[model samples]
Target: MKASAGSSSMLSHIAYFAIIILLISFVPAERLGNAEEALILIGFLGAWRYSWASVNFARAIYFRRFAYPREKERAVKDYASRPGAAHAYFLTTSYKIEPEVTIPVYTSVFTAAAKSKGGATIVSSVVDGADERLIRQVFSCMPCDMSGVKLIIDRIPGTGKRDALAKALSLISRNCPSSSDVVVFVDGDSCVPANIVDQAAPFFTNPQVGALTTDEAVDIPQPGFFRDWFKLRFDQRQIMMCSMGLSKRVLTLTGRMSVFRADLATNPDFIKLIRSDFIDHWRLGRVNFLTGDDKSTWYWLLKNGYEMVYLPDVRSVSMETQPKPTFFGSAIALMVRWFGNMLRTNGRALEIPSRRIGLFVWWSIFDQNLSIWTTLAGPLSAITAAIFFDPIVLPAYFAWVMFTRYMFCAMISLFRGHWFPVSYPFLLYFGQLVGAAVKSFVYFRLDRQKWTRQAAKGGQKAPRSTSERLKSYGSIYLHVLALGWLSLAVLYLTGAA
Candidate 1:
């Protein structure tokens, strides 16, 4: 199956590139007049940006393929057979999690830890009383004796995830004595495979590796628009992380599930950083992070010169639940949180010396901010060309979108269970435009947001008075006006107005 999918992905790439070359060659010479020429050039620039991203994505998928380890049973046996092997600890946090999702996640962790040769510890920071009992019940129901494992359930004050995680880290530091122990963090709504320890333990053999993150598959059994969208996000994540893993620098140690060395995770400074980490924005001053706790942890590791790995074979299935009833509403809400997290941390991550991190990873970090605009260039430029240059330009651009994105969707299919959906082309554009717009809004209004799922404000910024609120509105108006004028200027300069 792997071979078949790989071959299909290769053909998709080849066909896409070939189609692009053919389309360019077939353009009518008459359309190359001066006015039409400039508009076409701008449209092609957008196409070029799209082409570069598509190529990089393909390369990333290839690099990720080599990161998955073989002979998994032997690796697990070798790691476990050693005397005085590292003890493994599982730390997870939850808020308003359903019994069905919370129970299976903890159960799987208990089952996996019970089978390991060394002792294990499970720490859960939970908000709901019922979730705590259900998790304890999972521990009690374990078939094997958990004589060596300890279970500590810290009931948080419903402050937020950051607080819950901080509480758990404090508990672990006081109780866990060994710096060499392996600490695995999983979300409340995620289930780890039973062989998780066996798969991840062997990687710690390389002392340079400070942390490891695993591949994920979302469990959204019910059919709906959100289900397919959730799967697509995971699929893209696998390819991107795989590519980034080849360079030994994954952008984020996914909060869904990641393994870290106890020394780094429980360090006094690391714990404090995770609890109150804030970035100094040029305009916003010190902005405390409200979400993206995973990113905070990741940035800490990168700054300290720790190598991070992506284990493609180690799978953690996350439960997918839509917070909003409408697909568009849910997508926007999620992106606001997700992209807001990225934009907030992006500044500090970029400042880390490239010598410590590689050039590829550094450039990739920079690209996140630029991608918002580049991703939208195609539609925006094509529309401008259609309005002013030639109607044929729009038709040609649509043709390219159909052919290239369909092939891109085909390549993505290699990583998913179901074939790529017909709606993917539309969904692709929706995610691109909507995600970029949300990223822009959050970039400016970094202080004005909340964790929609958790029902918590992302920052503790004090409320502004009426006059201050009006000033903010004025700033937004000027920014929007400036952008509109800039667009018109560019169109006129390019002879497309």
Candidate 2:
């Protein structure tokens, strides 16, 4: 697949350059007016995406290079000198993750718990006795002073993460953590630094800050579609996260690893929201949340006017697996779930006052709603211009896409992903174009929900009736049709079509 995509890109570059050479050599300046007009439209539409990405990449650099280091220095110093620091609770839920992955994950938790010094708790919510035994064995093998560490195991029916986490939160609240104590939520397949508690707990020393999520790097079993795709996506996530962190707020408290004040984590209202989150959509009507427990946590913090921090320097390793070995199927499945969660929560999040969340944060949420249509404008404009204006518009648009997308991949190489990914340009374009369409599909039918990784609890929705299915199909078609009309109308008014 990589070879095929590389070959296709090479052929496209050759064709694009050849056309440019032929046109510049033989075509008269006056006669090239149509192509010039079409090229202007393409560039104008592309400016939106390029500008957004450039600003975000720059903000991320500022956060990582200049801003976060000072915050870390202060936090670390304050932590080292403090006498009576609070407890650290490492709470993780394992449903059916493999033992190979789960072992190191729990080992890291045990190690961190021992490092906390002021006594810590490890809450593991598992389904079976075998898993409980496996966790105990892993805990026993830890080479550290675990006398200060206490392990609590909860047996849960393998329902989903929401239920498991809510149960664990209830258990922690029972212990009644002190004002300064913190709870760390770790996924069963993630390994945190042994000093994660020491590093993150200090940030909570500030009374205004409520939660924080750190940077993540992937640990793949082997190289394949999964590794590259995950890297590309994480690179994007890293940039956006750092950008948001500069605001003293992040979009989502990633479930892979997030730290919250024990007081807020113990709040019954907070735990209840995660367990039973629902949005009353105008069309869909009271859509229940199945996945996206992370979004729920973030929303609770944001609405309550609590400051959330992002620690770019502190990192965790995610042990990722192929949801479906095939790249297309797995990538699409994830985009659906991921975007569905964002689309569901972002609207309600937007309802919060700008004064409450800050102006930039408010506008960023607004952009999330606007970007879906804006992302489609460039391609749809190229098509409209080609039909109504000139055929050469097609080649100009194709050449522009090849140049711009590759430029984007190159620029982001400063962050996480590989510097020289063979098919990155194509993959980036595929993700954007197809991802936009998927967002549109899910936007209209918000009731459609699933988890790509958890096979047992995936697709929790009941079967739809025939008439209900037709209504969904009709809603999606009309929304798409409206988008097409809007794009055409814009291009025509601009005299590009």
Candidate 3:
């Protein structure tokens, strides 16, 4: 069956390519020149957005055969039993996290910490310490005695995640001074597995490894389009992260959970970076970043030449609940915050010395800035060409999209231990179109954002200052004008306008 599916996938790819070639070859000579130009331009735009991910996808497929079982698991166990196994400390931050999610997340981490030779400390941050008290209650109910672990509930003044994390990091750094100690950052809604420590902590034995992150899967008890959508995102995330791990560099140390050497996490400089990291935008000037603390940490490690590792064997399950009732609204809210973080930090992350980041990693960072436009380019260009040149163009483009995305989904599921869902194609288009739109909005409105998960009463200042609001409005219209001009030019030059 596996061989049959693989063969069918290959045949589909061949058929798709053949159709594209036929379409290009059969155009009339008079129209051929314009068609060829349009094809070249469309092809390049498509490949520009896809080529790097394809390369990473290929690398991931290659690494899976040897790396899947993760030979390092036994080594991790041996390392943990060793006399001086690094002391483990956890910094978990919460803001309005549901009780069901928070309880299991703490239970898993604390249960694992109890078995460790070294004691662990949990510095949990909460809004009113109400949930923090609930955490203490949950810790007390652990099936086994957790004498080795201690909990410190830190109540923040209703600030955002950055402040909560900053407070936790500062407290841990002061308390756990040893360079050998390892501090793991966990989200209140993330449920880690029992062997997470045994699998993750051993990597720190390598003195140069500044941080380690694990693979994460999402759990959505109530099933629907949103649930399926979240699952697909995690699936793609797994593939991309595993690919980066092969090179010992990851795009981001996901905020869901990541482990860092105590020295790095505790450094006053690192804390300051997390608290107030920002980049000097050409138009915006020193734009203070409000989100993506994980990116800030990852950039600091990269710039400083600290090696980061991704442990695919250690899986964490994040409990995902849609904040808004409607899927579209909820997804947009999430994307604005997410893309805002990525764009705000893109400038500096790319500037890290090339030699330190390597060619592929550097190109990936550069592509993040370009992809928003490139991914959106195809649809917009195809629509314009179809309206002016030929109606067949749109149908052909849609066919290509369905075929290619289906194959891409199949390939991603090759190493995954589960079946790929049928809803993936829909989710893929949604992500491309909707995600791109959100990125474009945040690209210009860099200073405009808020924590989507935070309560409205948190009383954080609004981002609608007169100057900022005007700039955001101007930026949106300016981009629209530019896009309109570009589309018309493409159509005219290709004889389609």
Number of the top candidate by TM-score? 2
Residues 230-330, candidate 2: write the lDDT tens digits. Answer: 87777777889999999998998989999999999989999999889999867666788999999999999999999999987789999988787687888
Q: Which stretches of candidate 3 lie over 4 Å from their true place?
A: 1-36, 47-50, 67-82, 456-466
Segments of candidate 1 deviating more than 4 angstroms: 1-35, 65-82, 177-179, 415-418, 459-463, 466-471, 474-482, 485-494
Clashes of each: 0, 0, 0
What overall lDDT, based on C-alpha atoms, would model 1 receive against the true structure?
A: 0.76
Q: Encode model 1's per-residue lDDT on 1-497: one tens digit a residue.
A: 99997788568656756766676666665774534644565566666666766766766666655434443344456666667767788899888888888888888888878766678888889888988888888899888878888888998788888888877888888866464578889898889888777678777766678898988888987877888788778877877787788788899988888999887788988888889988776655567888888999999989888889888767899997888889999999899888888888888888998888998899889888887655655466666766776656654665677676676677777655457655565577677778877876776767655876776775434445764475466547755864576467557655676
Poorest lDDT segment (10 consecutive residues) of candidate 3: 455-464
lDDT of 3 at 444: 75
TM-score of 1: 0.87
Candidate 2 deviant stretches above 4 angstroms? 1-32, 35-38, 416-418, 455-467, 470-474, 490-497
Worst 10 residues of 2 by lDDT: 455-464
Error of 1 at 356 (Å): 1.6
Identify the superior model by TM-score, candidate 2 or candidate 3: 2
lDDT of 3 by residue, 1-497 (tens): 98998787567666756766676555444653445656667787777657777888877765555663463664476576678766788888888777788788888888867865677788888886678788889988898878888888998887677888888898987785576778888888887777666667777767778998988888899878889888888888888887877777888898989989898899988999899887776665567777789998998898888878877767888888897989999999899888888887777777776788787788777887778777777787777666666656665677668767877777777767775656677688889888987887778767666777765321123435876656666777877886777667677755665
Candidate 1 vs candidate 2: the lDDT winner is 2
